[model samples]
Target: MHDYTIRAFVQGNAEFVGFDKYAEVFGSTTFPTALLNTAVFTLVSILFQYAAGLALAVFFRSGFRLSGVLRAMFLVPWLLPLIVSASTWAWMLSSENGIVNSVLGAFGVPQINWLTSPDTALLSVIVANIWLGIPFNLVILYSGLQNIPGELAEAASLDGAGAWKQFWSITFPLLRPVSAITLLLGLIYTLKVVDVIWVMTTGGPGNSTTTLAIWSYREAFGTGQPDFSPAAAVGNVLILIALVFGFLHLQLQHRQEGS
Candidate 1:
């Protein structure tokens, strides 16, 4: 990979001479677009997963009938292997006989080409990722909710606090730690989400769904010609983003402890 990049640099086809490959990749338009797409994908997945998971956690915490069964059912997707999950989603989103299009047809809607369309391809992968993520958040948050002191809620109620008030004052506060952990872990997982996109789209439709990870993989392995330098550059960018989140989370925890 490095040898090819060096050769490319030596060929003078790329700018900056010896580091031509790096310059071309870094200076290319595709790099920025890939970064933006990935950022949006990660942000959207985390937002929806955390929100949906928190809601489910709250609902299941009430000990409603069949809550245990429901919780297990929600976790089924998470228990599946990632490749299996991606493949299943790919089948489900296929344009012709896919369940998604079938349902749309039943409702008198046009069949949508999820994987083939650049507009919806990234979103299709994001939806699959959200499915993979929500269960984890639910399990963690539900367990955290279970660990909170019942006495605190009871005390709040005794002080004439309503259910909503008690929850805001007691339940949500106690779940802060759990929420933090969930968000941090979710960010890490979403940052590295490649399989779902790979299996479903292969960064297709004019590279609309190309993420940094996918782009890096293609550069290193695609075209039967490896270029490790650009791939390494992409890897470093992803690591840097993850590291930023990790560092921020740690600082927040330390400050909370000190306070």
Candidate 2:
């Protein structure tokens, strides 16, 4: 990145000159748009995924008939290959004849241009990612709940506290450490996600879905002027963000262990 394509140009691979990659990256009209899309996509997806995962964790933590089978079933989305998930979602979100639009039409709602419209393309990918991430969050949070002393919940119930109160007053508080780790890992993973977005929209509909990872990828791999320097610069920026969050996760884990 520091050399700014000088070596690549020397090797007759690139045509760009000067250390203008960074400037070009930041100055581009799509840069801020991509940043905004990334922030909104990651935050909204993680928020919904954590909530759904925690709810699923609580639901199946207790003994119930067929619970084991059903819990395993819920993980199918997470266990599927990234390419499979991406392709499946792409078809489901297709603007022409997707199942999603059909369902919406059946409910008297207008069919959505899910993957075609810039306004909804980012949202479409975010929904797919949330579905992909929930099972992972479920397993982690469920394990944390299992490790919590059951006596505390029993004691709260004995004190006449209802289920909701017991969860808020006892269970949820004790699940804090695990929740922090889940969210940190979610943020890091979501920041670098490329396959889903690439397959679904290719960061398209006029760059409405372009994110840091997608931007880096297109710069390095997309045809017509492949430049490694700018891609490296963008990728380095993405890695820096992930590393900061990873460092925080380690610190949080250390403090939890120390206490």
Candidate 3:
């Protein structure tokens, strides 16, 4: 890739720099923190999102009264625009007069800063992201649940299997294919998350929440003086990460089928 900059773009005077930009990005001080944040954010969000979604899907599958209405309500977070959701979270987590703090205050807890403190900024965004992703997992996993034959559960119950045993012995094993795909898709989505985080904390309180995606976006557009080449390099690294996971998924699938 070429060493492109905002001024060079306007003047058509870009110069080829080969891997210099990549070298610079890898050597930068922020790269390690960004990489670690990205990893923690992605892994934590996916794990909780999938667990909560699967639990909700199973709950709704029980055919309780008003279940449809409750499930529909769960989709509200997913239906709302990212900016709206992020802004709502930001408002709710405000240290002063926020509903969260107000409720905590009633219980004799301190008013803690959610976004302003480095200690909790990353956690704040992760919580918001997990909330946003649960609906997606719920929908997909719920559909997968439907494909499982009710007879299997019926037979397991008749054989004296408890709910937990039925779930572990029959439901979970049958849902493996669906779970794999859901996790893979969630990983890809979480990897490029910027809008929600940007709207909430702008990767701040001092790069505490700055993932690789944020780093790339900040370099390219967050500032008035854009550094295009390094942004491109970081973007490419993200792509490589996604592709590596995708290929690993394929390999696992192939191995499963072979076995």
Candidate 4:
């Protein structure tokens, strides 16, 4: 086993050649593009998912009829296998036979090559990610909303505060911990997203939707020759980013608690 490990490292090092591989990656334009795409995709999807989840949570928290059933239905997307969801969306977005384009065409709107067009490819992945994540955010925020004492909102409303004011001043402040935790967790998960983008775009139509995780996979295993060192570096970078976000979340919670 030890000999095999050493042999693997030796073969991998032959290609890496010290920091040469690192320099090549940094100098490559595709590297920066992948980084930017991943950042945008993660940020936009998380923001939309969180906001939509919060709205849904608040709406369902109002105790409407079939609220429990509706909540379970919303969660169905998250519960489904991610690959299955991604493939379904991919088929739906296919320019020729996709239901999305077909419906749009029927309405006199132009059909978009969602997964094939460079401009639309990354955004398409983000849409899939948002759909996959909404349930997670909704469930977490809804539980948090349930734990918030009703008396707090009632007292705020009695003081001549309107619904919006009560929510902004009382409910939101109490949900801060829940929000912070969800945001950080979502960030971490988004950073590592691969299956949806991989199954949908394969980082193609000119490498427009390539993310770091996908890039790393391509480098280490997808290519003709395996490059483990750069893959390790990419994984390290992702871990560092996740750690920083987690630390910031904890700090935010500490400050909120102290105040």
Predictions: Cα RMSD each:
3.7, 2.2, 1.7, 3.2
Answer with 2 or 3, whichever has the higher TM-score: 3
Global CA lDDT of candidate 2, please?
A: 0.89
Clashing pairs in 4: none
- Clashing pairs in model 1, backbone N/Cα/C closer than 3 A: none
Best-to-worst ranking by lDDT: 3, 2, 4, 1
Off by over 4 Å in 2: 2-19
> Which of 1 and 3 is the better model by lDDT?
3
Which structure among the candidates has the greatest lDDT? 3
Q: lDDT of each model, Cα atoms only?
A: 0.86, 0.89, 0.94, 0.86
lDDT of candidate 1 at residue 158, scale 0 to 100: 91
What is the clash count of model 3? 0
Error of 1 at 109 (Å): 1.4
- Model 2 lDDT per residue over 1-259, tens place: 3544546567766655565777878888878988898899899989999999999999999869999999999989988999999999999888768999988888998878998898899889999999999999999999999999999999999999999999999999999999999999999999999999998999998899999999999988875767677788788889888989989999999999998
Candidate 1 accuracy as lDDT: 0.86
Write model 3 residue lDDT over 4-105, tens digit each, in one string: 987889999899888889999999999999999999999999999999999999999988999989988999999999999999999999999679889989
Q: How does residue 231 of candidate 4 score in lDDT?
A: 68
Mind giving the per-residue lDDT tens digits that candidate 1 earns over 13-85?
Answer: 5433465556777898899889888988899999999999999998998897898998899989989988999
